[model samples]
Target: MPFSNKVPTIYDPRIGSPMLDAEEANFEEIALKSLGGFVLVLNDNGEIYYASENVEGYLGFHQSDILHQPIFDLIHSEDRDDIRQQLDINFHIPTSSPSNQFDIFAPPNSKYLERNVNARFRCLLDNTCGFLRIDMRGKLMSLHGLPSSYVMGRSSTGPVLGMICVCT
Candidate 1:
């Protein structure tokens, strides 16, 4: 089905177990898109499995262009160590632990612009886009009993199955 901003209702079809009912799901999808945001579903190894279409609106790169790429490839090299540190923290958190949030900021410095994987980052569109400073807030979740898409993963592995990464 085409992605929509409307909330999902009871009648909406979800491939596996549903996280939100039809209406709520639709509403969230819509809200995220309306806010010029998109979602990414990544495995423990930091490989992106899914990239919502709205990513083009936010990053200027099409979803197709970034699919299957390691998320770190898009990050500034100077910031990679920090990202790794954060990912390590996420993986160490047990399933029973409370939800945690992390903030990663990339300034529009030469270091950041020099590492842009896509040329689009060279164009300063706005504060939110291009090499201007991008702030990412990610929630690291434990996938003990979620959908197979999250558990079995695109490539089956212990760490990949145990982690759920949602980035906006």
Candidate 2:
């Protein structure tokens, strides 16, 4: 099934285990393809849990090759620290807050905070291409109690991260 931007609806019948609705599965694929990028989901430890198939076209690595691997492993060494810092939840917490609690500029200590990153990633298919520049936009996802079927690989019982990366 293709990925969709909508949260897949779990359909439960009296005779079967819950399953994703077929209609919503293609939304993610359409969204990603339109953007000309791929999606990545990572555990708190930064291990890859899922990578869209389009990654092969953009980064030259098959999805299987990077699954269960550290995302940092594929990042250019010089850019690893920067990417790590941007993804670090602690780094986003504001040290001071505006006098008004409702200020939009005030960073919220919430799981939904979004992160943006620009970095260079190693190209596995062609070493001659060296590293390719990538821009990523994503948000911290709280997946506690998320059904195993909703995510790829192991079931996530804690917070997970997700990103959409485009090559430039």
Candidate 3:
């Protein structure tokens, strides 16, 4: 009998690979097709690593122009301080508590962007992006009594713009 990924991963090791639901390996494909929004995966330092085609629509700038830029630059100036506080709160929140994980503090001077525009700010390292992900969930903000229009997120550059930074 041969071991499956389960041997090291799941209880069923000798049997054939468990078939995932129709939604198995196709999650990315399905979501990508359905949502049609940009998915940017930033490193702890906030550099743009994985940006989807939808990024252009989300940020107005082309992927080529934004690569290696700090995610913090796009944030509106007004929200920066509040966003910074929220990021601090997020960093301190316990990892096990998902409820404490998100925030709703919008960036300064940022109303829901009529058009996407992002700017990058350099960090003290002069080479490394400073932003660590301050994970913000839009749905969570609404659940916490924040209005749907209120922006939610964090930036490494400084504070946030329109996006709300929910602090603990």
> In the order shown, what is each candidate's alpha-carbon RMSD?
11.8, 8.3, 14.9
lDDT of 1 by residue, 1-168 (tens): 444544434343565433445556466556765655456665456666677777776667788988878777776556656555544433343466453432212242212111111211222236554443354445444434445665644453333321233333
- Residue 35 error for model 3, in Å? 2.4
The alpha-carbon root-mean-square deviation between model 3 and the true structure, to one decimal in Å, is 14.9
TM-score of each: 0.49, 0.62, 0.35
Residue lDDT tens for model 2, 1-168? 433355556645775554666666677677778877778876555667778888988888998999979889998889878777765555565558443343323365453357778878887666548788888777756545435655556454334554433434
Ranking by TM-score: 2, 1, 3
Choose 1 or 2, whichever is better by TM-score.
Answer: 2
Highest lDDT against the true fold, candidate: 2
Q: Candidate 2: which pairs clash?
A: 3-28, 3-29, 4-27, 4-28
Candidate 3 lDDT over residue span 38-100, tens digit each: 455443344444455555544455767776665567554554554344323253334664733
- Candidate order by lDDT, decreasing, is 2, 1, 3
Candidate 1's error at 128, in angstroms? 8.5
lDDT against the true structure, each candidate? 0.49, 0.67, 0.39
Which candidate's TM-score is highest? 2
Ten-residue region with minimum lDDT total, candidate 1: 110-119
Q: Considering TM-score, which of the candidate structures 2 and 3 is the better prediction for this target?
A: 2
